[model samples]
Target chain A: MIEVAGVTKRYGERAAVDGIGFSVSQGEILGFLGPNGAGKTTTMRILTGYVPPTSGTARVAGFDVQEHPIEAKRRIGYLPEHPPLYTDMLVRPFLRFVATIRGVPGKDINARVDRAIERCGLAPVAGRLIGNLSKGFQQRVGLAQAILHEPDVLILDEPTVGLDPSQIRDIRQLIKSFAGAHTVILSTHILAEVTMTCNRVLIINEGRIAADETLEQLAARGGKTRRIALRLARPGDGVEGAIRAIPGVLSVIREGGQDGAFVVETEGTRDAREAIAQAAVTHGWGLLEMRPITLSLEDIFICIIQGEEAA
Target chain B: MRNVLAIAWREVRTYFTSPLAYVVVGVFLMLSGWMFWASLVRFSSLCLQYGNNPYVFNQLNVNDMVVRPMFGSMAVIFLLLIPVVTMRLLAEERRTGTAELLFTCPITSGQVILGKYLGAAFLLAVMLGVTLSYPLLIMATSAKPDVGPTLVGYLGVLLLGLSFIAVGLLISAMTENQIVAAVGAFGALLMLWAIGWVADSATDTVAYRLNQVTFGLWDKLHLGLGGPTVGDLLNKLSVSEHLGDFRKGLLDTEHVVFYLSVVFFSLFMTQRIVESRRWRG
Candidate 1:
């Protein structure tokens, strides 16, 4: 439902979003992961028709954002980083106003607002001034405003940023629930958020797309080589060579500053733990600890970003 | 149109929900009411002083002495108060980041500018509407206040108020700071109001110099380029100059056109500034 091609947003000589291209299919939840100043917000703005890209085009629901902004924007619901809320308005009335501008029919405004309020769990504070709500509740109100018109696409920037743990969980659950019904593209610096809520992740670094892959594909990428961290009780010579001689064991390196501690790399398709244990016993090297290290999403994210920077 | 009204409705609702609408309207009414009472007292005293002199009494007509001056004071009051009403119209949107919501929505910049202009204009209308009690009170108590001039004077006030709002809206669009917008609009409106003084003072010197320069061309071409002097053009540009006709109960199309052109030009510029945001972003 969204396509961005060769989009570069430059301010003077500095490009905030360098020529980045990505497409999202209908009913897909694509998570945009990037650290600060990674052009996440700039990309979302371009897709939402808030700011025109300096170089290329972004199309939403088959309409070029610059050429047919009204039509493209009609199908988009954007919740900016600050939420775009009027603090003076009551929650319900504010939602109604948003619904009106989002082109919700007059007769259906109240109904749609109620549904959004209910969905976002804003019923208790519906009649209260938005300024008086807590940050989490205000964020919910912002979410309600974005989803009020039930647009086909939802572009949220840092949706869960300042919320407490529980509020974060609730927001992530709400976003996860949007999958398969609404096409969502949310940007965040939180790695777990993508793991919990999105099926695919796009990692951006320094105005470039460093990595874009499905979560399973990312797991498999990290799975190509398995590392086992082994600590031996007794000091031993040739421990690394002995471990490397085992079948299916790729290589073994002794860890620094620790006696008899070594990391063994092996083929992902095979298990070399039993063979290593047998070798340790025969050589009188007591196997104190042997654990396989699985790469978490955080590790993969940092690896991708740092790898991009290094290159 | 629905989008425009939605935005307009939001603006109007925002005004009332905050203290802005009530405070501005209240202060405007109190000041205008005091001006009306002061002028009425002065008019009654003048009547008593001229009670026996038909010549001065006839010259002291109610429309001339009371309603006309009241419209003049109201115009001045609007010059001060309308900026306050318009300062937050667009500036607050930018400050609070609501401009993202507005620009990203399925609406044009023209719609946003028009909606905001109409919203403030609605408040301006209400300010003018409540003051109608002044003229109505005079008609009830006084014997012969000309209704034509009074109504025409109101039309003038409305147009003047609209032009002020348009100018204020344009200034508001140029900045994110409400105070800056308010002060800038006040300065611009004051300049427009006082521009006629500069014209009056410089007319002879400037027009004579222009006539000297253009004398040979006019003599050669037999053209009437000498008709409107430099001062005449400057006076025509002054906002207060056009308001004089409305205060005198003269609904000259020329003055109406002038006030309308100001409104149109300011609103058009506001729209352009708003649309430029996408490029500048």
Candidate 2:
């Protein structure tokens, strides 16, 4: 439902969003992963028609954002980093206003607002002033407005920023629920958010797309190399060489400042733990601990970012 | 149009929900009421001074002495209060980042500017509407004033207030700081208000020299361009100069068009400034 090509945004000499391109199919939840100042928000703004791209074009549902902003924006619901809320307004009235401006049918405004309020868990504070709501509730209110019109595409920039763990979980669940019905592109620095809510991940660094892959593909990439931690009760020489001699074992590195502690790398396809434990016992190293290490999404993200930097 | 009304309604609701509308309205009414009472007192004293002479009493018209001065004071009051009303119209949207929500909607920038202008104009209308009671009260307690001049004077004030609002809206759209918008609008309006004085006192200034040259050219060419010189053009550009005909109960199309042009030009410029955001961002 979204196609972006060679989009670049510059402020004088500094390019906030360098030339980049990506597309999200209908009913796909694409997580925009990047560190701060990674041009994630700039790209979303260009797609939403809030800011024109300095060069190139972005389309939403086949409408070019710059050429047909009104039509393009009609199909987009954007939640900027600041939430774009009027603090003096009451929750219900604010949502109603958003619905009206967002072109929700007159007859369905109330129903749509009620649905959004309920969906975002804003029913309890429907009549209260938005200024009086807590940060989490305010963030939810922002989410409610973004989905109020039921737009075909939702561009959320850090939807879960500044929320507590529970609020983050609730928001993630809400985003996950949007899959297969609404095409979502939510940007966040939180790697776990992508793992928990998105089916596909697009890791960006320095205003460029570093890696774009499905969750399973990403997991397989991360899973190709296995790490195992080993601690010995008695210090011994040649422990690293002995571990490396085992089949499927890749390499071994001693943990600094720790006696008889080593980390072992092996091929992800085989079970090298039993072999390593047997080698430790025969070599009289007195193996005390042996555990396989699982690489998290964060580690993968860092690896991609670091790899991009290296290149 | 529905999009415009939606944005307009939001602006009005925001004004009323905060203390801004009430405080501005209350203070405006108090000051205008004081001006009305003071003018009434001066008119009464003048009537007493001329009570003995029928000729002098005939010349001391209530509309001239009372209503005209009252309208003049009301215009000045509007100049003071309109900045307060319109300062937050666009500035607050930028400050709070609601402009993102507004601009990203399926509406044009013209719709947003018109909606906000109409919203502030609605408040201006209400402020003028409540002061209608002043005319009714005058008719009750004293000799009836000329209704034509009084009603036309209200129209004049309304148009002038609208022009002020347009100017204020333009200033508001140019900045994110409300105080800066307010002060900038006040300064601009004051300059527009005081510009007429420059025309009136053009004795040895550049305007006088230009007026002399234009007059000599008109005389040499026998173009018969009577009654309009460079000074006249400067006076015509002054926002306050066009109110004289309305105050005198003469609905001159020229003055009406002048006020309308001011309204149109300011709003048009405001729309341009708003549209520039997408490009500059």
Candidate 3:
């Protein structure tokens, strides 16, 4: 539901967000991964209509951000990097105010705010001043405001920055719950967050889109080899030799375990479990556990960044 | 209009809830009260000198001797207090990053600037409103208190307050620092207030040209001039010049338009500044 075309934002001689373009389909959770100063926040700001891009355009729900700002903004729910909260305002009242400005019907404001508060788990501190709340609670308040109106598009910048582990999980779950309902584009420096919550990842570096693909595609393209961890119960010195002798097996290293635990690195994505299983049975090696090691987003991210640097 | 009211509502609530509001209102009332009491004491002692004598009645009317000067002094007080009331309008939002919320909302730049201006103007009106009891008491106790000029003077101060608020809002939008906003607004207003002084001292050759742009409440209408001259033109520029007519119970459309134009012009500049921020950001 969001389309960005050659969007660029410049401040004097510095280009905060250079010409970068991407689109998120309806109900898709697109994770924006980038290092600090990668112009992620600037891109979010331009999409939200908080800042005008120096070149090109961003459209939300088919409305160009600059030409039809009110219409475009009406369909967007933005949670800025710092939350953009009225610190002195009570949590509930602030949400109500946001609801009003977001074009919620006068009669439905309370119901909407309550729903947002509930979704963000901000009920207990709803009556308290925002400035008095802790950082994690404040981040919840920020999330609450972004989803307050249930906008069609939610653009969040570092939404889970200051939360505890549990709070972060809760936010991640909440974001995941928006699947098939709201198109979400969240930017963060955290690589693991994208792996856990995002269906697709867009890796940005130096104001450019270095990589963009589905999570699975990214992992497959991570490298040429597929690594698998195998744990055999029987003690056999020849087990490692047998596994490495199988075709497509590149290398075998003993990964410390009870015994006979070997990490078999293969040259391709083919499954070598059938070959290894037959050999294990023949040799009377008790086959215990075997699983393919998928590439984490961290590994994929580092690889992409390192490859970009090398290029 | 609802968007304007929503923004205004938040700003007004913030002003009333914050310590800054209480401190500004408290300090304003205390100072105005003191000025009121001093004016009353001066008028009363002067009354004693007259001793029920109708001869000196023409020399000392309550409106001129007490209310008029009190309002003139209140106008100056407003010059100082308006900045304090308006300094945080846009500066605090920018500093706290709430401008992102506002800019991203469905509201336009014009709405934000107007809402903030109106909120600060309303607070200034309340501040001026509280001090009205001084004139009300004079009307109740004094049989011959001139109500026309007193009410007109209040109107004049309101207009003056509106002008200050507009200017303050513009300066507030120019920076993210509240202190700098306050001081810059105050300094700009002080220069406008002091420009008339320059004209008065140099009323010889260059004064006529300088007088047109200077703002002061004490400037006369200069109606006797057959046509507009440099001096009359300068008199027209004085923001305070129009208030002088009001203190004398003269409601000139020209003065009304001048004050409104300043408010409109300042708010327009403020809107431009807010718009530029979005671009620069």
Best by lDDT: 1
Q: A151, model 2: CA deviation in Å?
A: 1.1
Candidate lDDT (C-alpha), each = 0.89, 0.89, 0.85
DockQ measured for candidate 1: 0.82
Which ranges of candidate 3 are over 4 A from the true structure?
A226-266, A269-294, A308-311, B200-235
Per-model TM-score, in order, reads: 0.95, 0.93, 0.87
Worst 10 residues of 3 chain B by lDDT: B216-225
- Candidate with better DockQ, 2 vs 3: 2
Sort by TM-score, top down from the best: 1, 2, 3
Please state the CAPRI-style docking class of candidate 2.
medium
Model 1 reproduced share of reference interface contacts: 0.92
Interface DockQ of each model? 0.82, 0.79, 0.68
Model 2, runs deviating above 4 Å: A246-250, A267-274, A308-311, B200-229
In candidate 1, the residue pairs with backbone N, CA or C atoms under 3 Å apart (3 or more residues apart, or in different chains) clash, namely none
Task: Write one digit per residue (lDDT tens) for candidate 2, span B141-232.
Answer: 76799898899999899999989999999999999999999999999999999887867555344444544788677446654444455566
Using TM-score as the yardstick, the better of models 1 and 3 is 1
Candidate 1 displacement at residue B199 in angstroms: 1.4
Candidates ranked by lDDT, best first?
Answer: 1, 2, 3
